[model samples]
Target chain A: MKKLMNVPNDVVDEMIEGYAAAYPQYVRICAENKRSVVSSKPVRPGKVGIVIGGGSGHEPAFMGLIGPGFADGAPVGNVFASPPPDPVLQVTKAVNGGAGVLYMYGNYAGDCMNFDMAAELAGMEGIRVETVLVTDDVASASKEEAHRRRGIAGGFLVFKAAGAAADKGYALDDVVRVAQKANASIRTMGVALSPCYVPQTGKPSFMLGDDEMEIGLGIHGEPGVKRGKLGTADEVADSLLSTITADMPLAAGDRVAVIVNGLGSTSQMELFIVFRRVARLLADLGVEIHRSFVGEFVTSLEMGGCSVSVMKLDDELAEMVDHPADTPLYVQK
Target chain B: MKKLMNVPNDVVDEMIEGYAAAYPQYVRICAENKRSVVSSKPVRPGKVGIVIGGGSGHEPAFMGLIGPGFADGAPVGNVFASPPPDPVLQVTKAVNGGAGVLYMYGNYAGDCMNFDMAAELAGMEGIRVETVLVTDDVASASKEEAHRRRGIAGGFLVFKAAGAAADKGYALDDVVRVAQKANASIRTMGVALSPCYVPQTGKPSFMLGDDEMEIGLGIHGEPGVKRGKLGTADEVADSLLSTITADMPLAAGDRVAVIVNGLGSTSQMELFIVFRRVARLLADLGVEIHRSFVGEFVTSLEMGGCSVSVMKLDDELAEMVDHPADTPLYVQK
Candidate 1:
């Protein structure tokens, strides 16, 4: 793969510089070692600050949502790679807000270890800190142990509810509770029709024949639970949603928000086709949809196929879901 | 070429039904013939209503931007097809608000004629209508005749600015001015790495080998101006940006917003790789970037490749672009 960089090592740095320059009005970086974009203006003095970090390829998730009512700071790592603890510490220190800092991100092993190290370092500096790892992609693990499902699309929902909780002056534990609740209620399953090529590798992570699809694929191109001849939209929707429903059954009259997220390479038309079946199936099961979004929300780089995420909502979750959010990633009213 | 639909012909309608059902709070139907979405609540009497429409497959574009400060209504047609005049007229009539409706969309010939006809019909009903067709695809037309270029990702910039202008209570002509300014200054160029298979056709829209890419391709699967071996992110960005800058010169001190959009199957990683090049190139050129968004904006089914868009900004354009706008498609502060 041809790239437009001085070298492969400079790619992430250059991208960050451009992103910082472009969104200066909304974000600013600390002079510290780890690259971090703090809110242009802090929310309040002596308030708990939220810092979210992860790999860089998922635009709008770790970067675009860095503003008020979201992350106070985001220390973005390179493509699919977690940032070092140094950057995490720098970002936490910059957005301390005098009260504390909350570290939130996906439940990746690399990320967990690095952020934990960063938290320990920050704590030594007398900065109070807490952490919540979002684990929402149910397909990553078995139904009996859904918590082990790697976090995928539900990162946004956790960020929204927790960010709002933080913005509403909730304490650190309360904010964590909101995020945990959102994560627990949210379930996602994905399929991969094609694989994405890592820039450094220049080779596809996986392969799928023209007539085949791997259901329950991981966002990072990990092997799925099943691979078979491609099925119809209804069948795919049923296959994916059945697992999600079995894990989190929405009783009749239950209200939920659905997200048919394209895993990078899938088209919106295909996502919506599956969404059509999802909506029909949910309605036939007597579930009421509050608000739904179908798009490439969380994605595996260039992978073909999509994931369906249903967030079982109560009045609180519904309000937060409907709350007006002004991020480059998503805006809802 | 695999699809999820049971039948190709019913795909569009089924998708619409799901869209309406999923987003009832944001959409409404008129007499069971027209589909529309409300951008703001408690419609402000005499406010200039902004209406945009196009084909259905371009989710969040023709329809997704319908929300506060952006588009009031978006009526979609079949996939990659223009909406009929009745729904256009109905959306215009429903959101007239006495100030008139500003019809904005891409510069496709079908859309141009049908929206023009709708404007004429709406005018006969005492509704003042002005239209601005986006011609921002610099690669498709010669520099001297860039206005004839087909609209692509650049439509997002124009839609955003017009949405903000309408929110500020700009009169019909003034809103038209913003849209025109955005269209004139914005430029986009796309390349397709693989051909897309239309659902109804079950065949490739265009043909290309595994090692090839078609540069400057249209979003509707139209052939690009050039076909050559697939190249690097830097090479692709340089080719697309050079054409855009040559057509819409970006001087040392000029501020602009950039959009690195996936044509469809391109991953965020690849898009970021492209954005990495684009940002560095613009920086080397000494251009100021006000904002940058990279993702799947306007897509062509599941075709792999990407497009780059740049919108030059003056003081007026910058303010409008920076202004608060909310839509299902995009949101900004």
Candidate 2:
């Protein structure tokens, strides 16, 4: 596969260096651990610290979500791999302003293990730490076992809810409460039209025939719920929304914040087309779209596909959704 | 080519409909012309109206750049083709406050002819309009003939300068001056690792060998100045900045803004890797980078490549760069 990179092993380090260099006004690498990135904004007293992180390939996710009214820090990992406990500990210590620290990330096995270790280490230092696993992907498990689901791209909104609450000087318990609530009220599904390449191995992550697509494909290119001939944009969108609505039980008069996310390589034109069908389908269902975000939020190294995520917005969640944020990747006034 | 679109012929319309639907608070489709988009914010009484447009494939360019402190109107065209005079006229009328309107877009034959036609029509209607064609692609023309160069990703900075001026309530002629000045001070060059596909015909814009790349490729996947085997990220970035610095003669104590823009399918991992090298090269040259933007800005469907743009920031230009813009794709406070 053709890729624009130098030594593959250094891709992660170089990416962090470049990201920090490009936005020094927003973030800085932790002095203790190079892999950990702390917000340029200093830790505020009495405010709960928000820390997020995951594998490095998904640009502008955990790391990109660091700035004013966002995460206090992000401990980065290697491509498609979780960070070790040391960097996570460093990030937690750097962001702790005496109140406490809150840990948020996608619901992945490796992430859960590493973050749990860091939280244990922080507790030993007299700093309280809380954790919230974003499990929003509907395709990963049955609604009865929603806690076992994967996070995927829908975690953006979940993090938004937590970050907004934390930035508002909410207590540790309150921040954790809103994050868990956001996770519970969300569902996401994605379809992959093409495979991605792993930078280190220089190999395809998965394979798909020219006329095929995998519905509900995970961000890491894992197998999806269904594999079938590639359908039209509307068909694929309708399929994703139908599954999500069924699981979430959305109905008339229910309001939501919708995210039509490009996995990677999929253009904004395609994402908007997908959103067009989604809007039509939701209108037919009598549901109201209070806010719409259509773009590449989470990505898997040049994978071709899109994901649709819906966050049912109750009054509390709606306020969090409209809260202003200033980050390198996302901004609102 | 695998694409996530339905009824290829309706892709453009659907995309626009979805985009407007997604940001109704920011934009509205013109009642007179469906292809024209006007800012939902009514035309400011004394502010110079900023109108930008081109083809459909380049998302977030002319269309996505519509909102507060950005373009007030955008007239979209078919894939890689310029819009007709009707939409342009509609956008001109929609945005023309009592002061006047300023038209800014890339330097292309079709765009020039169509925009000039609209300007003439608007002139007859008693609305004074001025035009500034961005010609920042250094590889397309020499310094002596820079006006003939094709505008590529660097047009973002050019438009930003003009939009900021227009929103600052400058006269139409003053907005045109800064836009022209920005076009002259900026230099951009791109490389293509893969080809893009048009939905209408469903064919590749160009072809490259398995391990080859085209340097200085245009946004439309047009022929580049050089084609050779793919090089390392550092090597390619050095080549691009080397050429830009050569044209602009950057030196010690010089300050500027940098943009490392992904063409389409290029991932942020590769972009950051590229930016690391760019920052290194500029640092070695003793140049002070005032700001840096690294991500996908202007795209050609799903072409895999990137572009580097440098804008020498004088005090006047620096202020414009730091100004606020709240568009759907680009946002700053």
DockQ values of all predictions = 0.49, 0.84
- Per-residue lDDT of B1-333 in model 1, one digit per residue for the tens? 777676898887777666666666666555536454444355578689988888876666777677777788887888888887888888888788999889888988899988888899998999999999888887777877866878888898898889889889998889999999988888898888877777889888888876788988888877789898877667888988998887777889999989988777765555666787788899899998887887767777777788899998999888887787655556655
Give the TM-score (vs. native) of candidate 2.
0.99
Task: Give the TM-score (0 to 1) of chain B in model 2.
Answer: 0.98
lDDT of 2 by residue, A1-333 (tens): 888888888998888999999999999999899999999878888889999998988877879889877788999999888999999999999999999999998889999999999999999999999999999899989989988998899889999989999888889999999999999998999999988888878788878899999988888866578898999999999999999989988889999999999878999999999999999999988999999999988888899999999999999999999899999888887
lDDT at position B12, candidate 2: 89
TM-scores vs. true structure, each candidate: 0.91, 0.99
Question: What's the residue-level lDDT of B211 in candidate 2?
Answer: 90
Per-residue lDDT of B138 in model 1:
77
TM-score (C-alpha) between model 1 and the true structure:
0.91
Compute the lDDT for candidate 1. 0.78
**Model 2 chain B worst lDDT window (10 residues):** B220-229
True contacts kept of each: 0.52, 0.76
lDDT (10s digit) by residue, model 1, range A164-195? 77777778877777778888889888777877
